[model samples]
Target: MKLSTIALTIMLGLSSSTMAQPKDITIRLVETSDVHGSFFPYNFITRKAKSGSMARVYTLIEELRKKNGKENIYLLDNGDILQGQPISYYYNYVAHEKTNIAASVLNYMGYDAATVGNHDIETGHEVYDKWFKELNFPILGANVIDTKTNKPYILPYYTIRKGNGIKVCVIGMLTPAIPNWLKESIWSGLRFEEMVSCARRTMTEVKAKEKPDVIVGLFHSGWDGGIKTATYDEDASKKVAQEVPGFDVVFFGHDHTPHNSVVKNVSGKDVICLDPANNAQRIAMATLTLRPKTVKGKRRYTLAKATGELVDVKELKADEAFLKHFQSEIDDVKTWSEQVIGKFENTIYTKDSYFGNSAFNDLILDLELEITKADIAFNAPLLFNSSIKAGPVTIADMFNLYKYENNLCTMRLTGKEIRKHLEMSYDLWCNTMKSPDDYLLLLSDTQNDAQRLGFKNFSFNFDSAAGIDYEVDVTKPDGEKVRILRMSNGEPFDENKWYTVAVNSYRANGGGELLTKGAGIPRDSLKSRIVWESPKDQRYYLMEEIKKAGVMNPQPHNNWKFVPEEWTVPAATRDRKLLFGE
Candidate 1:
């Protein structure tokens, strides 16, 4: 089983248990994060057996509940459950009239409380608002505030009382960097507060009003050092845990890396932090024990022990009752996923996109150009490693071909801005190959917890331009790598001339900082640059266009390639094996 970096042992501030007159009290929290709709043991997209599922997590939770009693065990989740698979899309769009399968499943699992993730917000207000209404327990996001009222859009915190007169207050906050990725229409009227500021303010409120014995932070943010701007931090869980004094245990997600650590708060108190990676593969469990003590001749509780670990759920079989309970919904999603959407004349692998122009991304780029009739197009591979074979394509294949439900965006960009954007992308993607032996890809210097060869930046941010002939000189520095020769149609590419560009909604809204940092466009002024946006998502159009075509012969545009082949050719082959083990 794969386990993420387990940093440190659990450290306790305080704990409570449910034993009428017990000498020591122990409280346990079982947390799952970024499940991404992996409900069953089967992978709906792959049509194969996968490592983890919420059904398995349910089995483990049931075992723990039976052993510890429900009163002492609290089931928690750290969101991002609304996207990623055909099942979520089914419930999100197809079965909108019915209750969301996510709500039903989490409700059946008896989740104590949960936090709203960025993807949940990405589903837009209609979907998340409906799911939020259907959930039996509250979903928290203290930092997500209503613009009009200046109050939290959702409940800031929820208090759960155990049978043994113990109050556990759970405060939830998500990453405040939503504006960088999402369009305003998706999260309209809600503003995100920075994690540290939000945590400090909420902590003060919790101490004053609730005055609970133990505080648990269920943050839908990741570890520190994600995207940091002067306004907000995208991954501020570590920062919040370190700065906020009252929290006993902090469970975070959204980075999709499991971790366990102990960090001292501002008051110099020990705080346990844990993050369970995405897809229900593992969960974080913290058992905190508090022993009775005397303070000023009064009965008080002192921390005895605090231990947390990442429990692997990969080996566990799917719980039969859980599968049976959601049988209808599961079957519906499977049927939808399996429905034939189109056919492919040849297979396209996303792996090739990393090297240069490939059919995988070119298909998307070509489709965008046809749809928008723009002079230029920009795209990046959404999936890390995925393929669509030369045969009948299903809805599942469309999901792999296009990951996010981003709308198609047609924007205007100058030829100079286009050059800058490509430079920034290659800077994140490829390293300066000074010699033939130097790596072509910009892999990270250090290994992450899972011992994987991590990229210097997210692959989804490695945008490449189509509709123009260009060469990226591997020996050149960051800003000077890309050299545009001419348009794909043999027209002169003037740097000063403006051209209509097709892009994904995320990019148009300033995701990956490509437009803002690379193209030198101001973030707030982005909307003015957009010429048009499709009503439906890119995925839907990709499916419809392919279906209309009868069969797609996927091929790379061959519009661009890496220069100094003496270094880049062998480097590409070596780096491919290093990254994919192929």
Candidate 2:
């Protein structure tokens, strides 16, 4: 054969082989956020196995990987994994000398990356710093910068390569509102930058340097576009998706609400945005299809389609091996949670707080007043409908009572400001009743569904005041609802008098905007107004108070009441049944 003919034949064979390769590839990305230490299919509060768990989520991930090919699947956690149940508390505080169970589980599940959450930072440097060091995968936090170095405190972002040489760059960002919710000592040397600004800067760098085929943002914030009183952007995931152009997909949590949609960017291109909710109840999945195109006789891939959805994991079965591997830790947590601290003389339920003052909230108020010796105390139910029966109160019961690791805070406020705060709370918590059939508690048809009635806002923010007598008139408008009667100690209420008020750090730091907006207090001056702050979480003090008392007999202070009892009482009773189906 001639040499020219042989060369031509070889070139043809090479071209044929290249053409045989697939023209397109589809990859699936899965995310879990706000895991909050739910590694097993068990609820510590109820002391029973439940459906939501990382173990169950692992099973779903495994099934999806098997169906979609392991190389084409990537798993990531958005954040809030360090603190919630006793399992995490044990590893974080009780058994700090050993390996972190949360990190170990993430490593075992083969996570690609994770973002830092405000609650994770609330665990303090010693806990999260140790956990971050031990994690197998990179934990990204581009906005959480160190003051000393003026650079990212953790891995700003990470890039992973698939089987087809497709590079996916995942960047992580946290809410800048950390300073507003957390104490300075917890995040001492770190500064959380605004999400939009940080995303713009990070995306530019990633596109320039990595030139990744896909850019995914793992944010530990919500989808709200509005700014809070403390930060430039508290929940700026939607803003980041709208303003930043490089991100192909954005996965967010922190609001604990499930959301999935495609948002239009500044360039008029669509970006996938997703939030899987909290405690492994759901998982967010993003799928991208890349098609190969020949440019100058070289094959290149471009994203053809991107879509996102939230998958509910309520019915998924837990992975047996995953559960078995961590059975000892599970048992340890169970035993610790069951240890009786003290006894409650009567059952305390949160349902009563919705209508009038309940022992459930009054107990918290009592602890705050006792701990701080403040002139007045304010509190709200952190959980919507949690209850504790009359019996021995275990460590787990405390978790049910106090949902978050919030510290006790006492600030100075005038009587007028306190009244304004109550007015705001009542406005959000109650509705104007024109007749006896009208609903006493605020009910929004827009927020409710066929399954259950939902409040316009979180019921946890429905605050009530103690140490003073007041009345909420359901027939009046919002600003005119709350009327101060007198002090609980039989003294006349003075609107001009300054008094110390004890509350949770979240309230004092403007989490619900009651203190800053309602009270008309300057956000920057809030820290200086602090009369006293608890060194540990409020739950810690509650446990100590319980241990010291040995017998807890929680009773309502009866300082506040709803007016026009003839109309309000029946309406509240009917609404309670409608809300709880009891």
Candidate 3:
């Protein structure tokens, strides 16, 4: 019989036993990860679709509480709660002057504990520190430690005694990749221990010191592969099962894949692991039954099999009262989004290439170049949203496009840095440009260089604009030959010149390990010094910008080309069979 089937049968048979009867002690873990500060149900794109909203999630949590009683439940956020949507920006910046609505809503929801995600660090330490003070729940992470202070920045682990007096040890763990991905400044003093080691150390400590009956891992680290082989994260969870000796259940997050499976550890014992995807769309439910006993002279417990499912929110009734309050926030955001700030005579489009030029990308570069009046400009193409249709765009549209709420900032880059940037782009495309058959356009071919570029140079210039052109030479490796030919103005770009480029404040400050390091360029992009008269809402600006361009029709601009310097013609590079001969 399948493990789940057998486990279920065992539980059913033991259901009404005097010793196994359902005790007053029940534990329900409701988790939401990678919410990214989406408190309002605003699309920020079409401003139509009902998504990225915490109101609905809040309603669902309320319903769960009603059905399962709050005294027996714990609401936990798996992390990445601080970034993603514009409300994060609204709360971090605009609402900095007021109480953060996102925090208010989460606090109101009564979260018991949470772990951090890498994106949460993007908010910078000061902001995070300030906001953390407002949280009622203990933020847990055994791995994230301050090198200078020699203490974990967040609570490493804590134990909770549930209603029926079941002492459960909850250990939180954040991914160790935080330092490698976030801006250097934000993570300067932070050091992450390997996930498995951290879990082992903490769980061993808890077992020896506290000896909780049920040990639950509120792991913010993700499950890397299927349940069998150890992905660094899986090693951590499985190790907890084997080394720690008493782990009953593990709740996972960060990777956003939903799964509930039993992982057999080195000792050939089983541990239950659960992960439900992000955005508050689903909840992971694991029901456990335990029979308390005194073995010899010590209290021992019998733990049941771990079985779970991703509870679908669509099937639940939304809390209407909560929805009404969240709806008001949405309405305010919408009203703020509708006001037009600029106009355009032509329709300007962004590029749609998985790996080529985009008019949508052009607008962002244009804005960067124009704002700084730089000789050349750069920004990541993935940052943009889906292409807009013809008509008046709104602030909501801009927010949707730049969904991450990356503030604008300016940075100076030297000619050499510029060349390095373009070369990196080429390297990115070359890595994935495997044309086994020249006739077949590989579906894996993508447009943005940064997507595949291994190098982390090239700072941001956030002046989003309407017209720009450039070609990248992708053939050469980093350091010498990669080139950028300016296409926006159809001019032979000067290589020896320095340009002031505007970019999102995050990138300007070297978020994503941008070229700010050792580039010798002065950063004038500090939040206080930068002048931003535009409201937090961007839909109006997007509409205004599009209107100025008029009659939007984007043409192929391969003029900015990247030919490989060291070209390798693969053995399978022969032309493929064409369905309709071209």
Candidate 4:
């Protein structure tokens, strides 16, 4: 053979070998955040089948797995899955077992990894510690560190491999505000670090050590405005995506808002951030395309395209097999929730609480004062429009009345501080009416939407004070709205006089900035102000109160009202009709 022909033959053989290499692959990541224990199609509170549930999400997951292939998909949960409905509460407290129903369901669903949420911590170590150990997949939280070892209390992150030569790393972080809303005893021996600093440090370490192809962030915090300072970084997912360079995709929860968008990172590259909302309404889907490349005689993969979007599971069918597996537990919880504990002589509704003193809210205040022996009590309607018809009261009714697992806390506050707290609460609850035609309550376009007419602020934070005669003047500005008359026992109100006040642990720990901002109490000093605290959840105490009372009658204390009823009543009436309809 000729020399030129031999060289050409060798070149052709090398080219053919390169062309026979395996093609590039694609991987899909599916995530659910803030499931909040809505596993079944049923709404345990209303006792009706709801549109959003984990059962529906399972169907969506099965479809994606089949389409993309099981090995090419990653299934993750972003936390807040241990509390909310009767089923979770039953497994958490009522039934003492080796594994919880929430853990069982997630394990059976084949979750690749998960994270811990604030609510999951609210279940205390007894519940979450056990549930964490029972899970098959790794539950991560890099920011939750043990004080003794000064290391991560849980698995910080998990690294998994997909089709040939591709490695994906998922790092998890939770909001550092756990100390602000929970007592020290609940989260003892562990400290939650600020998310931005934690994320930056963790990502740097993971990139150096793992050197994976793609980095996914599973954050249990939400994306708020551009506030990234340590003290005010409750929701820092947006800041992390914008400031951190290694993250390719970020998933967030804890705010209960659905979002899917791209933000610029430190390197000026676009990074996808997604939130699937709460109650299993939607699932976040991120699709990444990888292509093989040969550099310096080494084969590697490069991420070509990355996109994130929320997929609604409302129209999807429930996974029948999964539901059938837990049918017996579901039925037992339903039976326990329906067991009658007491009787109400008259029906009370939550709508009345927005206007002034209402039987619905006062009933809770009465329970707090009775149990704590405090001079005054403060509470708000946790549910927006829940009501209990006169006659039979069941465990379900207790859940509707007190939605959270907050413990009852009694704190010492002076009269001046109490007045200031009420001013802040009413400022968020009502508006300064320029005239009768103006709206009494602050309602935004989103609140007035055709689907729902809710308040701009969470109605649960619109607190009302009992055991004192007061008036809220809507004509005045925020700080000057409250006017205290006298105590419920007929003593003149004194700003300097100290009094024992009963509030939920959420407020006592400054969850809504009520105690810190309104009462002028430092956030760090909140725990010192607690005079007494209930052993169990406030709802448990309320249940015991109802059983002791036997025949319950929910009545308003009528200690406070909105001034200028001529202007306030008429405006509130019109707005209520517009907001709630008749």
TM-score of each: 0.94, 0.93, 0.72, 0.94
* Cα lDDT listed for each candidate: 0.89, 0.87, 0.57, 0.88
**CA displacement after TM-score superposition, residue 331 of candidate 4 (Å):** 1.8
Per-residue C-alpha lDDT of model 2 across residues 513-533, encoded as one tens digit per residue:
787778888878888988888
Number of clashes recorded per candidate: 0, 0, 47, 0
Cα lDDT of model 4 by residue, 1-582, tens digit: 698999999999999998998677788888999998889998887788888798999888888789878888899999999988888899999895847998989998889899999999999999999999999989999999999999999988889776456788999999988887888889999999888788889988998888788899999998884223446588899988999888889999888878889999989989999999888988999999988777788776788998888999976789999889989888898999999999999999988998888999999999999999999999988876779889989998888889899999999999999999988889888889888788788776655221124676767778898889999999999899999999988989899999999999999988777787788998788888899888899999999999999998889899999877888999889878976797
Q: Candidate 2: where are CA atoms >4 Å away?
A: 1-18, 225-231, 293-300, 445-453
Residue 125 of model 3: what lDDT? 77
Residue range 55-142, candidate 1, lDDT tens digits? 9999999998898778878899999999988899888988888999889999999998999999899988999999999999999999
Candidate 1 residue-pair clash tally: 0
The ten-residue window of minimal lDDT in model 3 covers: 571-580
Compared with the true structure, the alpha-carbon lDDT of candidate 1 equals: 0.89
- Distance from true location, Cα of 389 in model 3, Å: 4.1
- Residue pairs of candidate 2 with colliding backbone atoms: none
Candidate 2: lDDT of 58? 93
